[model samples]
Target: MSLETIIYIIFAGIIALLLALFQYFKKGKNRSKLDLFFSFLRFVTLFSVLLLIINPSFDQIELSIEKPSLVIAVDNSSSIKHLKQDDKTLGFVKSLKNNTELQEKFNVNIFTFGNQLREGDSIDFTDKQTNVHDAFKALSQIYKNTNAPTVLLTDGNQTFGNDYQFVTNSYKQPVYPIILGDTVSYTDLKIQQLNVNRYAYLKNEFPIETILVYNGSERVASTFVVYQGNQKVYSKPLNFSKQDNSKIIHFTLPANKVGVSAYRAEIKPIENEKNTINNIQNFAVEVINEKTNVAIVSDFPHPDLGALKKSIENNEQRSVSIVGVKEFVSKVNDFQLIILYQPNSKFKPVLENLKTLKKNYFTVIGTKTDLHFINNSNLGYRVDITNQKEDYQGVLNTNYSPFYIDDMGFESFPPLLSNYGGVQISQPIDVVLNKSVQNVTTNDPLLFTFEAEGRRQGVLLGENIWQWRAHSYLENQSFHEFDNFIGKFVQYLASNKKRSRLNIDFQSFYNGNSHVIIKAEVFDKNYVFDTREVLHITVKNKGSKTEKTFPLILKNNHYEVDLSGLEPAEYEFSLSTKNDKITKTGSFKILEYHVEQQFLNANAEKLQQLARNSSGTSYFINNANGIIKELLEDKRYVSVQKSSKNTIPLIDWKYLLGIIALSLSMEWFLRKYNGLI
Candidate 1:
């Protein structure tokens, strides 16, 4: 059966023949015929020993009847064709269309990738270049959750993303890579990346940002033009920084519109580069003019009211309203803040109703204040004055700071209050200002406050306005100080009124022939999509001039739009909504349609590595059938068998002596019958 077996047979025969010769030679010896016969028997015993050393065996093996999982991934990029129209690529694909073994073994899912990924039974490769990296990424995402082996069919031309690198990594299953069509030579230019802001200020400079490009050996300079609808807004010359690569470029273009502006950027074709179709980039920008509204409310009018109102009303953007404390109680929630002046005698009635306003209030206390409500109510902390002292005639005027508000030094100014007395602050008062004059007695508390649960209140103990408002050297600048204290507080609260920022996430596929549905999430304040706003979307190939608009209704503040008819290409989408025009812009490169291709190829390669790593041989698809059969039959294929024989000298020869005596008896009988002694 084997070379070793054949050699053993030949050697055994030759040894037997040599034994016969020795017998013949010994028979002719007259000195010791018996000894010669015994020597011949010894030679026979040696031949038997050699036969046993060869160690022959016959084995039967059982193989697995289960079939391995098979996956098919076909390249559905634009370069691949759909029909048999005398095209080489198409012909090759058609020839393999009816592969029954492939069909029976694989649970197939077909996919195409260009600017997006599309899945289907049949697809025409779009006229777009392929990005193999994106294709692999898409496949990885799809099959990452599965444990299936894959079979990938492609042309091996990756015009877009990375390729072949995935094969270098490990996979859970074997990847059977079957390359389709012969690689060909083609020269083309592609725009690698385009970057632009979806939002910009109206009548401001808009940055036209993009990356200049070349794919193969193409070097040329071209003029790039920016178009706003049918009008050409800007044009400039651009040079390819890299002959077979890409370089970044940024230029400012004037944006004079206040709304969504449809724009396209084009580069005149060079010798090797494609025309404006692949060189142009389309996009849209939402120019925003953020508007803000402000309102002011007050209690019993005070001298500081005029100053506060003037400070805010002076700004054209701010709207100031002066409402009585009584009127504020009715519409308090309408305004940002409620400013209350020194109350009359008792504050119980006002403080009782204060809890119903549902708004933060700033209360200022004057000389003649009511202690009944302050001492009894939960809204304002109680205050008491100890020393009955008079204010200095000319006090050293310094900065007047609130408890938590910042303090800026003020020069000497006329004293607003004469014969003023400092008052004792309560435990609720968080901080205290310094006493600039000795007249600041225990009778008057400069600043004190009461903080309610869920509501904030600021109470100024002493009201001396004429000095700080009129005589201060910063003349009209005290407004900044007053505004800062109130501004930060109100703005901070307003910001917290809404929840996290809005964001949407989703996935899509584009087969070169069919349009992939474009879907995304629409998140709003509190995830409540009740704005009824209209979301406008503009989609364009990354570097191609072809562009399309898709409008969706922001229902319940969430949106999902579909773009059903489109060819495979690299696309960038710009989104804008009516309320907030500057929305989200996303870029997605579609993958060629292929099923199981990536996984099978990845798995096959892994299986090959497994075999090699373990001192086994890798097999191809054509060889898998026979190789598996052979491996299953050979037990050595699973593991090496340790030799069971051991050599040693034995003293037990009783059985051999018995056999020798029986043979001698038979020989003697034969010799006696032949009439020989």
Candidate 2:
């Protein structure tokens, strides 16, 4: 307590004593043992009340020891069971969790990871995919800014995410990896990867690329074959040794029939090969008879025109032709979709022709675009533009429902240049991307789509989209994602299908390991999205002649059904509404491919490198005991003693108020009993 508080307390006591004395011995009052007792009660009551008014506070100190965190991350992917190490992985984790000394020294937190990270020790080892990078990412967030040492139990054969070896630097904790699976090397021939387009034109040859790898020192000869059902369509002899262990095979196959076609690529395994499951791979492609032809009409040449053409034509079922405004007017009817690039006064004839013919077109606006011309053209939207140009980045509109599109890291893409303006859409539209300037998002649409009368139209309020394609390639080292996005946009505008009450979105083919989810949207008579309607899907396996039905659960703005439990085969499904007779039917094929079962042995080198980068050691399953001893001996992970101090006020103590009341009550009773009121 401070000196001021001490002085106040002393004065309070002196005043109480003086009052007690005056009450007991004033003038003619007689003094007795009872009087003394009454005086004592008054002194206590008055002094306590005064002390409460002062409300002096004292300091209290508390000490506590905070133990360091010990995270145990187990890989629960199917690769562990494929390698015959599930039981060993489980036993190691159980023993580690039950260790008394380690538990007492550190806070033990256990987690299991397959495609994602989950807390706890429930290990059934039935996960279909492995993503070690995501597991570390989650752990880094859970144990950030703490002394947490992680013990990773896995076979180090990741099949579903970014390379875990490259992401070790992101996590600051020490990672001791317990390597599972056999370390012995075996002569193996496997098909590493296969790439083919999702769709092919009927009667055309579709290209296929296959990468073959051998993992043995000795020379080996094998036959690579491509099969459709039970018949072999193509074959080649392949030779591999230590120096030439990899080969890239590229070929084309004729798509004679128009439907979902499943094919298998196999590299015949050598004799005595232990793991032959990886020698064969399955893929599928859909053949369609229709093709979308797009024409780009521009007054002058620009890189954006080329980029759009390449992206749209990436799908084998689409083709693009670029022409000048005058030339396009002659061949306007030849193409299904028209792309008007920065339309100005010279393109007035082309725009009028498109409107008259009721043809769908995509308008791309930029600095060269004439806003006055657009305002008078009656394209369902108008933009009030100024002389200044603005650089606007793209922000994805997650609620867009016209069709499904992935984010594809749009936030990191470079900005596009456009005239400074406010856009006003006169009709109902769905915005795929909104405008963001300097990181602040606006309500204006950057890329949007709308339907008028019986025709569909798409608009982009900016140019320089070529930069987006380039940036996408730089980030992912591929242009497939960017191309697929543009292809979907073109596909929507090229089709002449009218608006329907029931719409379903799904792919024609799916890999066995992928999630088979179908989304549906139902509309009422007035064409408004109806959420009260119940939806159901009836699926029939074409090969097995089995049928199953499932109810579609209502989501935020659509209905969804997960068909992941269905086995790999050709399926024909029909979606119907519960109250109405509206139904939509489609067929899709599921290829038989399990990425987790392709590994022959553990990826020991990469795991060792990961351990070295994180300042930890790598050990085999048999010698995993060393990890416990090492963690116990590590000096950096120790308990820290922390102290805290608090100042508590005297009035805050509830018992002081009780004591004051009791003393006052007792004094009043004594006075009343003695007839001294």
Candidate 3:
């Protein structure tokens, strides 16, 4: 087939030719007529032996017709164990065992699937989760053999990934699906949505919103209670409007302490049902009291100052301070945000340091600033008052507003800015206004906002925001709206103006190793943890998978991890824990040298799918007595057929042995005849 092999054959033929010629000449000289004939025969035999030495072989293989494999997929989910469904699956298993005709024709393998695949024996359907993807995966592995057809028996309830059809289609085997059990109408109630603030003040009320849904059921009045441990902090009556609808229940519960708080809302069933866990879902929200201290710096204390302070006081969590600009600049970084009230004309000297607290500063410009200071503030944008009315009534103008002390804190709201021609107005189109402000038109930049360095900055060009409180108090409205606005503005300006990032201290996994690796990510408030890295890790505990310490790794805006060799078990890992202070904690499962075999094969459903895909049958031991029968009854399982001639090459013993015997005998006879023994 190759040039080198051809050349080697030709060279061997040349050598044989030379040897034959020499033998012919030498034998001719010494032989008589009768001996010449025998010698010629011997020469022919030698030529034949030389040709056979090359060693060529040809084989004929006989094959039987391939039949579709019977894939016996069994559902091992808890639902399969339902009184009626369990009996059905059991009966089917028995039927398969008795059906000898079907057994003899198809190759059968048993498999069971639920959350994962269980080979050999079917998993008991005591587990509560149904996973159909596992069955498909199990059958796919068997279908790779390219000889067995797959048959599946399932109710077809999927509870896992979405690639079932894609994986099954890989093998061109026909899937014989056996529908099991009758489909029952399922009506359920569940906690559809929940909202909680992670950081709530200690001993203060925290607002929570919970949405409850009732599917396939009519409207019903229900009671929902919030429980903190054994204490029932709050409860309320909830009434659903109709079937396929939901009700939103709002609660304001007091936090007694500053730490992690576990809360659960229990919904009493209006209609008794088989399943109740779905009716009551438990959710945990951490109640943190890590509030930032804020200091407000204004040129002079005004009438609205008391109203602004009163709102934050009601919160009982935040501390607010009012000070002059001179004192604030001396100790600026001590507080979160600094509110400037008509700051001194020469505030430019501290602009660089002011930028350091970009999200931390809120400037409220008054009518006192001269034209020189207003035009040359060096604050990125200019703030100028084009109109100033002596007297004004604070009438409601815009219902929507997007302007806030901290732009990064909350989502944008509807336009709330309006023109108050009576107030000192900065005529421009890039501003937001509250509804209480005077009405005007166009995209006016009455306020310019930005966050530079670490502070949230805003410039309110209007002088008379305090008029809102004065006007509201005159109307006997209790100044609630004014207080709300000021409190929210202060909170936004003072709050942290950065994204959440994971800062891992160090991590470790133990496998008889005394020392552990410590790794961490270097980040600022603006950076996130997401990447892979190798660093020093620390170890804790006696080295068990159940309680191991692997500090979180930070790379590319995510926490990184590599638990390849961890033992098989659930591990509770944390990052940056000192004196029981855990920065973060998550659960991870490591099985079988971290190869994921335990997880990959944990669901019986996947195993059944793999078998079905390979044109083979999956089975379960609980009803596998018919496996032998199925194999025997398969049409392809007939007696082995043989060919007339050898299907495979065999040794040419007659020719080989004869050559050896004759060569040795001739040598002996020649020696005897020549008397040279």
Which candidate achieves the best lDDT against the true structure? 2
Candidate 1's C-alpha runs over 4 A off are 1-64, 77-97, 100-120, 124-149, 155-164, 167-170, 176-187, 215-219, 239-247, 272-276, 291-561, 566-677
Summarize candidate 3's per-residue lDDT along 338-392 as a digit string, tens digits: 6666666656544556665453676665555444564565555554346443322
TM-score against native, each model: 0.36, 0.84, 0.43
RMSD (CA, angstroms), candidate 2: 4.6
Rank candidates by lDDT, best first: 2, 3, 1
**Global lDDT scores for all candidate models:** 0.50, 0.90, 0.52
Count of backbone collisions in candidate 3: 99
Kindly provide the TM-score of model 3 when superposed on the true structure, using C-alpha atoms.
0.43
For model 1, residues 267-383, the per-residue Cα lDDT tens digits are 676774323355655666666664223333434556677765655544333455676546645654466555566665444444555576555666665555554445555454555
User: Which sequence of candidate numbers ranks them by TM-score, best first?
Assistant: 2, 3, 1
List ranges where model 3 is wrong by over 4 Å. Answer: 1-64, 82-84, 126-128, 134-150, 163-181, 186-188, 192-211, 215-219, 241-244, 248-260, 286-677
**Residue 189 error, candidate 3, Å:** 3.6
Which has the higher TM-score value, candidate number 1 or candidate number 2?
2
